[model samples]
Target chain A: MKYSMEDIARFAEGDMDGDERAEFEKVLQADIDLKSGLASYQNIHSSLKMKLSNDDKDKDFKQTLDEVSADYFKQKSKVIPITRYLAWTSAIAAVFVLFLIWSPWQKDLYRQYADTEMIAMVERGENSAALDMQQAANAFNKKDFSVAKATLENVIGAEPGNATARYYYAISLIETGDGAKARIFFSELYKGTSVFKYDAAFYTALSFIKEKNTKSAIVWLRKIPADAAKYDESRELLNKLK
Target chain B: MLKKLHEDHRYIEALLHNDKKVVQEIYAKFAGKIKRYIINNSGSESDAADILQEALIDIYQQARHKAFQLTCPFEPFLLLVCKRKWLNELKKKSVLQVTNIDDALLTIGEDVFADAELLEKQEAEAKHFEQMFEKLGERCKEIISESLKGDAQEMVAEKLGVTYGYLRKKKSECMAALIQLINKN
Candidate 1:
């Protein structure tokens, strides 16, 4: 009816033969105290085993997070490779073109044209809609009307309600030789609810800059908020208008 | 291997100090073994990933103090350390709560203290298993890995490109051979 401590330890370890294990269970059935002791031993052993097991799991999880983080960095670095390749190609192209043009006057003109084209290329290179709109604004500054208009349209295509893109797109049009089309786009950009409302108003005035309308540029520049980051630049450009 | 593990201790220390490359190397190095240990225990694939990461951190701490003197190969010491950590976590979760904290702490007896020395012996057992695994042909390793997926004989057989009947027989024979090899140690 009773089981020994040695029998209990062996059973807990699961080391006993099947017949002995069955016999020990039968003995445990008859004795409550023996059953309790066996249960305690089994539970403790199981708990330790479980603890060891979870420890293994936690270690594994940390390793996985590390792996995932590494993967993220690898993916980010992959994006930079194409960008670097394009830059190198452009540098090589510039060097080759420079060697072909021997006249100083022709080379200087070519260099200026290349500089403008490179700026246009960089502006068009930005894939982000917001960045495209910013680049469109830069092209408008350089008086590259057609490229600026096309880039702004691309930006607005991605973000239909982008007031800044619309305003810049309109300005590019008006300067490039489409006053009527510019007016409609500018009117729509101004009417819309947008973060670039002030820019929209300012560009409305600049649309007339193509017609040598210094009076309108001054009015629009003055309408720009004094607190806006671009207000100073607008003021300087407005001063040059007269 | 122990020497390599001890050397990796420096790498692990660098990881703890936020060296990104070393952390990546450590992750690549031990992730599989840690995953196996977790999967062998009562945990999911995701749990395995979690356990390995924390264990590495613990090892990192030990390495920082130069306390993780590798007397055995990295895998077993890592397995043991992680096992201990998981057991502690299971206790906290009370998933299979048997004894309370007081009784559990009190149960840390002389034998438990002897575990420090037994670690090296356990490492020998692990190395023995590793040696046996290496001795096994590639097909045997594949069979074991497939069999471990679950005991659905038909499914395992289909996955392993064998008939169910042959698969079962091969599995039993392989398992028996593996047991004998382990027993010989």
Candidate 2:
């Protein structure tokens, strides 16, 4: 007897009841081809199960997520920056450009002239000695030294009587890693008028600190005027040296 | 830049430290493999989606906890882990009771689970069945594909422009043809 499609389908779906299953087994025993067909069904189920299990085991879930997420983020970053730039420029460029364009020529010209005048005033206001002192101060701030010493020396050459310049030149020399030359300038400025007296006393102490001569630093610190702003910082440095 | 990683059971562990960039990389690299595996396992798209989500969660856990170490590329490790996790899930379902869990565990060898040759063969077999389904009149193919998805007989009949009785008879005939095609492969 041949197995109909309905019989096989029923069997595949377990539509056969308890006794029907028993009877189907009897039929299977008598027929090799039918047995093979049933086995194929079993194989299909097995293969499907194996494939499912394999899928579960080998799907590389994280790797896939990482790749997709990377692509998405990359796309998002690319799109957002471009769109924001476009929107921002479109919204602002016209007003900003128009403002620049509408500015009066005389105003612009006066602004340049004012800048030039400021430079000229700065150049003429200070004698060569005072200029050297300012240059050395700038160099000290910038941590430049060889040029600073040369500029300080230029100040002394042009005006040996300028105690303010002498004080600053000494400070510059000390800051430039030369405590020896700084001591002489600080001493001269300190002995002169009161203009550089406080600063000179402070830098004289600082120069000794740089030279690691705690004795001379203490002597200069004691000599600094009590009202000088440098008095507190000098006292602290003196304490540190002691 | 190639990341220098610690040698330990910490591949997924490393992933935990990775930013969103790395996570996205992991997903892109493995989604297709997971999808194909789920589909081949008699699962639908929805099933594939669920399985994939679960697999990713598993990887995330393993990674976060420093459980998975990659002796190979991250892709294979993830695949191996997810496949094992899904198989364990199936075993719990008791759909087919006689599975060799040990064999499955052993199957996570260096080059065993997602073997390129096997995937190619599966692809060819799938294509063969698709062609055979195509060879069947289009109506037969639609009816059977829907039926296999567990659609109601009447619904499939209506969808295929056929009466319920004709749909039932035609379904059997179509399934027989599919079985024959499968046998030829």
Candidate 3:
């Protein structure tokens, strides 16, 4: 006797009467293919249930995973090159250390904590916007703030909602002595729900510091929560400000 | 026989809870090795990162739904999952010049290997199931999704303006249809 899929489904769902269930179980014990089919159906049923219930939680987890992955890969890529460079520069370490200690840039609070390490954009294709982003990243990393500002302006023109581009563009603006304009972009980013939200807040504080507005900088620094990525740095900078 | 949970189950718990500190430790400890392995096998650091993230998410889903336990250390199991994912990716890309790494280098136990294989199979099935579900008719999709929302059948039936008996019957038919769709593929 061939068992229909509805019969298998009914059995799997426990929707059959006791007598019908008993009869189905008798056949189920003797039929390997039917047993396998029932198992597959049940697996899909439970998996679907789980997937629907956990979809939102899965998205939240993916967001966290993406953030951590970006940070991890960035650091991993730098490790090898930085180590090799350190090895070659170990002989000049004493002079370089002295220079770093007395460097005017090191004394500037705005420059000290402005993490200019733009998250490297993964080159997807030969699209001009992608090319512009790559060029902007290179220019920003090289501290060619003028070029980075120009390139990022073009990127933001094409994709105004590009938060990463906007955030980096703000930093480039600050680097090029346009602290007021940079704060506008930073304030906008801070108000959004991007991963750069706290980073934006922190940079807004830095922008205030660049303008010698220690009072406003303190206010912005205090807004960073202890759980935020920039909280510790903000606290440290707050101490220096006080 | 009940297998003893390894001390490394904390890592699995971390994935479940999205514990960033412990998750970062997992990266700090194990990510470098997996990154090196993938980079050695004709993959980039970005590919390694993607594979690692995907493997962790798969583990998270398995733990969430299947009550997956880590009976062995997490490092080898994580590496095994990531290695398998990268090999599968290379296969999809039709990269013929792939270099295969020996699994023997990692001290993976038999059970860990079996667990990883099961996860890979389940992930493939889940992907197939999701695609097939999209092909289902609107009514069937609504019935199945609404029924799975943990409401009483009568309540769901009322909410959908159907009788309880019809809801149960339709749910069964929808599930059966879904199974057949998967089988047809």
Candidate 4:
């Protein structure tokens, strides 16, 4: 005899009276389909209950996991052991001392002032652009500049007016040793009215500094207004350059 | 038969409680190896982070719902889980040229493999169940969700402005419908 879903549900939920439940159990022993249906129902029922009870806690756990994961990857990319540094320092100590004395101001000024930390890309919504922007931000923040450059290129192609993307793309270009191309984008951003205006100007100067163009570096640094975002850093760089 | 819980069960408990310090230790200790494995397998560091995080969340869900106990070292168990997940991800992306790792190198016990497989199965079922639940009709969704709140049936019925009998009847039908949906898939 085929039983209805209600009968299966009642039996699974323990809602059936003793006699009805006994009769259902007798059928359940004989009916394979009914038993499977009851099992599925019970599984779903329990899973739903677990989900309802722990959804908020699950979200909290995911948040904590994301935080720790980001920090782990970030530190992995950035930190160098002191032993490794000391090994390299000893190997190159004499040559470095000679170069440092020969050109004290010619030290890697780009490395000194190029803040490669990309601004946090706020996910405005679930759109593709926001997701791409986020991926670019993650790659950039993790110092994976090649991946960042490629993703940012696509983002720039899709949204030409995204100054954030433009700014970071330029930085990634510089990071990947294409400072010439980076300077072009940085120059464009510096002349625009985006929030990255003076910030772009500062990086443009750093790109020039990276190329050892002290003259162009000084030119770009002087363009940053005193009230601009990179004004203090730019002035310090300028002082050293002068 | 109840299996003996390993000392590493503390890691599972830490996940259940969202203990940041312990979770951070898990990352600090295990993340580098996983990251290296992923990078060697045509995957990026970002992919490694995602896979590791997902594996942990899967373990967390299994522990929360199924009383999953760690009966082996957490390192090998987590590595196996993350490796399986990354393999699945690579398959999904249709990425060729995967460098497969020898399972023998992991030195995972038979029981740990079985437990990881069971946890993966349960995680898939939970996801599929959630998808099937979404396909339920509006009234069915509301009734099932409300009824599962562990409230007294009469209270739930009153809150929904329905008779207790109606609530029970509708909840059963809704669950039946959900089961049918899941089976159809």
Candidate 5:
């Protein structure tokens, strides 16, 4: 039996009397195509409900959201200046410091255990990594230490309370021969109960070593607790440093 | 006993009421990560803005039509939908997938995936209905759009210069024509 538009419309609008509605429901049970056809009509009926409900309000909301979002992104994407010469000089000094500090055998050991937590840069949906922090991590992983250092500085400068970026920024600082500043940043991490606490202590020792300060390096290395993930590596490094 | 709603339901409420403060807070809270994801995946800032706005509209539509409830955090759900939508857009534009698109975006759960799947379905259905709606004759389109919107049928009939019974009959016929169009497709 063919269902009229009136039948579908009345059902959609709840305009059908009880006996008629009940009769239609019974027919709906018996006829799948008719039921599905009515369902399609209902879909249009409901879909239009929203498009007609104070269209101006929704249009305004969307317009405001678009403007606000565009403004926010514009503010965020502004590029800060990078002093290339200083970055290059720091890179050169860091390499020289590493060359002087380690023999080939110990360099291999440094290679063996210098592993930090894997820095993931592309935060797809909702992990807590900030934009500058992710950019820094990307630079660091690509061995672009100078870019990493500059970006990390911006991140830490803008958000000093970000313990994770501070820890990584310290490493970036050390990579760029700013061991003095790196060591201080790492100290803040080690003193806290952050996820990077023990790792920070170990890296702090490495920063001191880069500065040729064996005494401070030894002090930071010993701060690594036995339960820390890097304890054994710390001991190994401490033996060589001492 | 009544169950307590999730705190993140405020996000849905914010969209439903178009509360400016809550919407601004949403941008401040979540837009950065989505923008970064888009840019890193070879999309521009403009692309990110468009995708995000569309995603919010999809969410609003779902909330209004289906009474969307947030049982999980808003972050994963919003991101998951936005990321998927951007990827689809990229594919449609035939952009080369230079990077591992899956790994670049934030990871979410099966539930979030399910929510996104449901959202996509709802959107597809809306598009289908809308396209079929556009196929209707001008008067039928006008009568249906105006009449179905909770306006009195008699007033609509008078405005369209038709008898009340004629309006009802024409509306029925238009709706039936629409149903036929939908079934044909």
Candidate 6:
């Protein structure tokens, strides 16, 4: 109780030893005011210890923490390997990459939708003299897209607005890799009342796929009305996109 | 008394060692509970992030300071303090409290609460000490702050261009003046 502030500072500093520390511990037990003072000194000392030692480290941690938290929100609904969480993040990264490469829509639905199936036929109904519908159909089924493309274009040019010709013509355009012209036909079919309206919307999406623009393809597929023939397929495609 | 080390003591180790994996795991595993609690009780994910960061900083401080160790699962203790801190923050913002904020679902022992409370007190004490330390003469401020830096008090004394004996006396005098200033406030 008679010890100076130096004695208390030594005690708080844990610089006292053996008999010195033991004697002070005894004094510490009996004096409420002395114990309280020691606690204050100790608290202040450690607090400053933290402030100095941890200042730069906390700043570094805050930078990393902000990065981690930002990543958390980006992968919020989906539990993902934190990007900056480094070190074999690639282990979980494989799963994340698998998610990209193997989306249900990308592999199954989009593939199913994208398969042009060699266009079963590029001509419709009794337009025998208008353009060789039968020859075009045979050429298309053989997977000769250039042959199918030229014949389908002649038929469609001779008989524009023929729903069957328009649909098959768009299909051949997409297959022959003229998506620009194909989208023109697909858009026209989608805008007008044809049984192929929904199919045209679907093919419009397919045209985008041929262009390697999946995002725009998704937007076009999403336009398939619920009552349309391809509505279920479009919805499935959107689900995969999600 | 010797405290039993909890398995979650790895969290303290992670902070001490700056292990990014465990730290990210801390966010992945625990951030949602805090986020949901905050958002449900009238706080945004933004508020949740800030509150959780503050709480984690305290946890890191307590983990590094003194002989601090976790004696309980860190989740409840962390969430409880974070929830409490967020509520206090909301109270400061004077935001409308919609759903009556429920107490944390974690069955926190009084010991954990006391430990978290002690960290809070330590932080406030440090803040007060820092402000009061500035009130001392410029020489005392430099010496006092420098004194805490190195284990070799004599080297610190020499660096301050003072004799070893004078270092002790000056530290005691400076510390007393700081305590007195804090007390006067």
DockQ of each: 0.03, 0.05, 0.18, 0.20, 0.21, 0.16
Off by over 4 Å in 3: A1-4, A7-38, A50-54, A75-242, B1-5, B103-107, B151-163, B183-185
Instruction: Decide which is better by lDDT, 1 or 5.
Output: 5
| Model 2 CA lDDT for position B95 | 54
Q: Which stretches of candidate 6 lie over 4 Å from their true place?
A: A10-39, A55-63, A73-242, B98-100, B103-115, B158-164, B182-185
In model 6, residue pairs whose N, Cα or C atoms come closer than 3 Å (at least 3 residues apart or on different chains), thus clashing, are none
Tell me the tens digit of each residue's lDDT in model 6 across B113-152. Answer: 7667766777777777777777789988887888776558
Please report how far candidate 4 places residue A68 from its true position, in Å.
1.7
User: What 10-residue stretch in candidate 3 chain A is worst by lDDT?
Assistant: A75-84
Instruction: Between candidates 2 and 3, name the one with more favorable lDDT.
Output: 3
- Pick by TM-score: 1 or 2, better one: 2
What TM-score does chain A of each model score against the native chain A?
0.38, 0.43, 0.60, 0.55, 0.52, 0.49
Ranking by lDDT: 3, 4, 5, 6, 1, 2
Better of 3 and 6 by lDDT: 3
Taking every candidate in turn, the Cα RMSD to the unseen true structure, in Å, is 20.0, 28.3, 14.5, 16.0, 13.1, 20.4
lDDT of 3 by residue, A88-162 (tens): 555475466546534666778776777555544442233576578778877886789999999999988976656
* Model 6, TM vs. native: 0.54
For every model in order, the fraction of real contacts preserved is 0.02, 0.09, 0.43, 0.52, 0.38, 0.34
TM-score of 1: 0.27
lDDT of 2 by residue, A1-242 (tens): 57865577567755567988888888988898888787666444333322223232233443334223322221212112212344665457546544543454533321111110000012223445545655665564455666766776786686554344455556656655777877777777566533355667777666665555778768888887665546765665556567
lDDT of 2 by residue, B1-185 (tens): 34334343244554455443445444445655665565455544445445555555544433332233334445555566556555655677765543333443464554434332233344334445556566767766666566655556778778878898777666666667767766675
**Which lDDT values do the candidates have, in the order given?**
0.53, 0.52, 0.78, 0.77, 0.70, 0.69
lDDT of 4 by residue, A41-102 (tens): 77777777666555557777876675456545533232222233435654575465445534
Worst 10 residues of 5 chain A by lDDT: A75-84
Q: Backbone clashes in each candidate structure, one number apiece?
A: 25, 32, 0, 0, 3, 0
Which TM-score value belongs to model 2?
A: 0.32
Which 10 residues in a row give candidate 2 chain B its minimum summed lDDT? B61-70
Off by over 4 Å in 1: A1-144, A147-159, A162-168, A190-196, A240-242, B1-185
